[model samples]
Target: EGFLHRWSSARLMGRRSPSQRKRDDCESSGEDFDEDDEDDTENEPDTRKRKGGARRPGGGRRCPCGPTGCQRLVNETGFRLPANPERRLAWLQCWYPPDSVPEKYLEKKQFRVHECHFPADAIELKEFKKSGQVVRSVKKDRLPDVPFAQIRPAATDQPRPARGERQTREAADATRSELDRIREWVQHGVETEDLPQGSMEVLTAALAQGQQERDKHLRTKERLERTEKRLSQILSERDERERALRAEVRAPQAGVRGMNALSYARFCTDRWLKKSMSQWLFFDAVEQLNAYALLLDGYYPLADITFVPRQRAKKTVPPADGERAEMRRARVNYPQNRKPALALTPRDALVFWLFVTRSGMTLSRAGALFHISRGTAASCYVTMTEYQLQILRREFPRLSAQQIRDAIPDRFRKFAKQQGVKSDIGHILDGFEKQFECPRDDEVRAACWSSYKHLYTVKFLLGMLSSGAHYFTSRGNPGSVTDPDQVETSGFLDLLDEGIDTMVDKGFLVQESIQKRGCICWMPPKMRQNQKEATAEEADDTASIARIRIFVEHAVLRIKEWGWFSSRQSLSIQQADLHSDVVFIIAMLSNWRAPLIA
Candidate 1:
């Protein structure tokens, strides 16, 4: 009877199950329950005692029958329980302990409960129909009973055929009908003496057209083959000549190498020189190269760190006169007095360094291409890099506030005025990072790890003028350093004075530091600590500031395009000074390009 009542009530009340009803009641009553804990309670009744050994205070003794004993207690007490088994177990556990309860109920029952079952007549039928006493489901505007005649058509009593077989039969029927119609039409036409004219002439013309297209295709294919063969021959000759040049360079004779050099120069035409110079040497024209070579004239006898001699070992005793005399005699016997002169001039050495810097080629490969030893190549590279860095620093010094104001375009001046930007705005600042190899030491690795890039990197802060020319580039710092900290330590603040405004992106937090130096820092508006987003006015200010400040990032990109910074080899932490000098030189050289904004 209870089961029938439950079924009838569920069907009449929108077909919701008892568990869903219980959940709805709990939600309506504002009773929050831990569903996960209830599921565990049903799976293992003693989960709490097993996991935490926690017992409820002032509760009955632990029941040996586990969940079954608690359920019986709930029935005896006439306590309402949740419909879900898990939730029912959880509710019972709250009232009764694991031990069997010994409570007696005094409340009298108001209604009789009895079991309900189907009659013999109803059970005898193979198909059971819902009794009239039971309620029918009417949710979603659906009928409870559907007639068999309505469900299936009487004319089509057979089961449906497979899709593939059905489609094949339909296609065969269509083709047969179409063929019969055409045959009848032709028979009628023959009886009436009507037939298509010029049929053979149309067929002949189509065949001739196809033949012409085939001939054209054959001619095109033959032409392509001939062109490919000619190109292959040229490539083969070029490879042969390159092999002979390599052989001459490797030979010990200077004359052969000199002749090969002359031949190589002769092959490099003006067009080839222009293209190769811009790509491999970063110079636009031969005249630029000539002018650059002139810059190294006064910096004669450039010193290389690699050539610095090690400290002399302490002599225990003075060399013997006979030993010294024997060394002199041995030196005289060797070819060329055991000392070979340099094969390249100072200008050629400088060009060699630029080639290495622009192409990022390995020192060994560069040395072979230039017909010099690896050690000599290394010495030249180091020497030229050091001298060139010194010259660039002097050439690209930071501009004063007045010079920056003069260089800024008139359009930018008007925009700055409209945007309320100070007239003395000088430089825009931003920072960038270059990825490096992870160090073995934990401290070094942690220090170099960059959260922004999600890799180990070195960071540099760059400052550019409104005209997009870089004026200040900081030495490389650990990637873990923040933008504000890098700016403080990079000595850029020292150049700022009162009335000179410095622009920076939103990442910079150096307003206080810049103010301390008596300079105004113009950074984009940022959301406050308590705010989730900036106001409309603040967003407008940020957009206005970004319009001019983005050029600094563009300038930084130009600096990073150099082969040295973009090379596959990672920067050495041990030689941080050299890497810093390289970055400084590249940043300075980027100024030679046209302005980014213009």
Candidate 2:
């Protein structure tokens, strides 16, 4: 009757067992309810506590303590209680202390906080004062009343910030900042008993493991990309070799089809002889090839870094009438659109490419060594040099004021203490001379001879940044000219802007010219007998300037390491820009070897 009345009549039970009646009678009597003869509900295990002694009533989540006893319950543990009341109650039962004061323990909560940014100098001076140091230089009365990070502000003290305020720190980021150990919890949906007491430590360990796995995945991704790139390069090589083979197969049918018997025999014999040439040892390493070619490592100035020109038809004398007909060109297989004028193994091609940078080598010697014609070698040299000049022309660097600041070294602070930079722009410029070949033309030879060096030579102005990197190289000038004249003629002044300071040797002698452009010049003190010995300050200034200026000379030395440039035979009279181009290329190349400034 009770079940039918509690439920709708249509869903009523027909009868009740004696145990059920007994349980209902015990509940009504407000005593310990027992089901010793009965099992728990169908969903729970039989071993589940069902009665008293810390048992949960009806297997539902409620405080284990009675309502009267639970009024003093407190969330004292340093963890975020579960959102579910039942799970939270269960967690409290296991972790809550049994023998502590009954005072209520309230959980921590976050609240909106306000903060401020202030004149950082105020904070800095205050800290110094607290450390028992007197900073009398910057007076308290004249301090600026503003925040600053970007400027050369006036040399004055900063105003005091408002008293008793907390500074604002950036919001914590889980990815970039360390996780807080307290007042925070791991967000994983874990029950209290399922987690360790020091859950934050656990989370930190897990995050570390996750970071390591992410790094491993990134390394694997990079490795796969490198493998894919190498495979593609190999495929291209295979295709090129196959095309060349096909072209060779069709030679008799195409370029040499109409050759007479004698002409064909001679052609076949010459082809076999050329094919027999083998010189693989010259390019055992790519660096060796670059060194031989007077280039930086793993580079060429060609359209294809490895490709070479194909052999052209040999120049022949006028043929007599009725003579045996000769094939005008060699019969070989190649694609119609092939840009390479000749084909050889990449190694042999690199060998041929490097042959021109050698001094005192004629075209015949190069051809004999590489098994190519003298004309082809000469053509490759001309083409490669032009390409190098073009690339450098387009890609030269023009640094801004901020980059110039970065190029300045912290190591120069010692000098700055003595005499500081008033402006942001700065450079260390100097002139370097390299020997050149005396031209056959007497006028050109006389014009290029340097009285200082007493050798046929050319000079250039090199400017290096403070960070040990080459910034600029002036065009080649006649070595006969003075350093100041070389600098003026090479157009180094055109790059100067207001507030730039150029450091030069005693030879630059362009202080007035630099000052005219509204920039500063730092040069070593002159030692004239008419003048007394340098003062201590002047000596310090010269030493500082010399220390920085030495880097430009070191950069110049790196360029001259190329034997072709260091030796005396590389300069040419035919190409007006040849010496300049070589100087620029090597100066640029030095930037790759070691930075010039820092």
Q: Against the true structure, whose lDDT is highest? A: 1
Off by over 4 Å in 1: 1-273, 298-339, 572-575
Off by over 4 Å in 2: 1-368, 440-443, 529-536, 568-576, 596-598
- Give the Cα error of residue 124 in candidate 1, in Å: 53
Give candidate 1's error at residue 474 in angstroms.
1.2
Cα lDDT, model 2, residue 354? 39
Q: Model 1: per-residue lDDT, tens digit, 232-254?
A: 99999999999975674464323
TM-score of each: 0.52, 0.43
Q: What is the C-alpha local distance difference test score of each model?
A: 0.63, 0.55
Candidate that scores best on TM-score? 1
Instruction: List, residue by residue over 1-598, the lDDT tens digit for candidate 2.
Output: 8876776653355234455655777889998776564454323434433342222334323332223222222222112334444443443343245454122221312110011111344333323746786432222232222322222243346553346743223422442344443224335544445555566565666688789999999999999999999999999999998886454433422233242211212322455423422221123344444453454222443335533445464466645433323422444333432354443433344344434443335544544444444555556555556666666555566877766776677665456555744554377787677777778888778878989888988787887776777778888777788887777777778878677677788888999988998887877888888887888878987877777667777877776655446554556555556666656765664565536543
